[model samples]
Target: MPEPELRTDRLLLRRWRESDLEPWAAMNADPEVREHLGEPLTREQSDAVAALMRAEFEERGFGWWALEVRATGEFIGRAGLDEVDAGMPFAGVDVGWRLTRSAWGHGYATEAALSCLAFGFEVLGLPEIIATTTVGNVRSQAVMRRIGMTRDPADDFEDPSVPEGPLRRCVLYRIRRDAPPAARRAAGS
Candidate 1:
């Protein structure tokens, strides 16, 4: 099946486009944006990622979608569900988002995340969805909390894939399909 498009009040989570390659590269290249994720990527690496995303979406019917602003038709970044990377300590469907530095502080990540969560739970019928990030990524952690995901200190682990360093420490946050509607309301619904 073709990957489905998900919409929020102000954002559209849709398939990646050829037009998105440039800004997506720019976002990936931004140091502040990549501060927690990893080294900012070169244009070639960024394009490779987009290609992988397209391949993943085709293979699984769900993967990162190019995030676009509905009002302005701008390609802001990407958000959606993906499988836990290989060699992670645990496994499950995970929700994720990344935005251009310019899109920071606007609630787009949370907005797109909530839609992805709804699709994962309500449509995909997943019992649980997780979000993980480097422990220092308080911004993403906050988005996890805002979307009603809870974290257990015990669930934290060293990411074997990241090598020994600050970036190796990771935190996992999760929300079950049955979490209260009131808890999920912080999506600004």
Candidate 2:
């Protein structure tokens, strides 16, 4: 099944397209965008990641959908629910987003993330959705907080995928389906 397109007032969350390659590669190559995401990727590595995203959509009907500005149809980034890797201490779907630097400062990340949370909790009937970021990535953690996820100090873990460094330490945040109405309201859903 194909992932369904999700729309917000200013953005569109949809499946990856062949045309997304060039800009996706450019975004991945940006050092600023790659700051907390590890080293800037070579074009080949970027393509491989894109391929994996596509496979996820094909297999599960949802993944990290490519984000675009609805008015201009410009590719901005990717955001949505993804299955946490089995090696992680926890197992479940997680919400995440990554946008080009130019797309920063807008509320796009929160908007798209809220939609993904809705899909996970409402549509998929998931009990909870989690998100994690390197401890140093305060910007992303802020997004998590804005989206109504609460972090537990005990849930923090060393990300095995990240090499031993400042980036290895991660903080986890979660929101359950039964979370207070205030939480969904805070996420602007």
Candidate 3:
């Protein structure tokens, strides 16, 4: 089954299109946007990630859906669930997002992420979902909290994919089916 389109008051979360490639590459190339994610990617590397996302959607019916501003139809970035990377200690789906610099401070990540969580728990019947971010990525951590995830300091781990450094130390946050009522409401459940 194909992933169904998801919408919020101001955004549309849907599959990637060939037309999305250029902006996606530009976003990946921005050093500010890539700060916690590692070095800015070359266009080829960006394209490869997009290709992998498409393949994930094809194989699993969902991946990181390209995010768009509903009113202007602008491609902002992507937000959705993905399988936790193999090196992580956790086991289950993870929620994540990346947006263009212009799209920051707009609460779009929270809105879209709430929708993804709702789908993961309510639609897919997932028991839980987790999110991990570089310890320095406070903004993303705030978003996770806004959507009802709670972090356990004991569960923090160093990301093996990242070199031993400030960025390698990561924090894990999780939300389960029994999350708070406010959180469920945030997810539109």
Output the number of the lDDT-best candidate.
Answer: 3
lDDT of 3 by residue, 8-116 (tens): 9999999899999999999999999999999999999999999999998889987799999999999999999999878677789999999999999999999999999
Clashing pairs in 1: none
- TM-score (C-alpha) between model 1 and the true structure: 0.96
Model 2 residue 38 distance off true place after TM-score fit, in angstroms: 0.8
lDDT of model number 2 = 0.92
lDDT of every model, 2 decimals = 0.91, 0.92, 0.92
List, residue by residue over 2-21, the lDDT tens digit for candidate 1: 88999889999999889999
For candidate 3, the lDDT comes to 0.92
How do these models rank on lDDT, best leading?
Answer: 3, 2, 1
Give candidate 2 regions above 4 Å deviation. none
Q: How many residue pairs clash in each candidate?
A: 0, 0, 0
Runs in model 1 lying further than 4 Å from the true structure: 184-189
- lDDT tens string, model 2, 3-106? 79998899999989999999999999999999888999999999999999999888998888999999999999999999999899999999999999999999
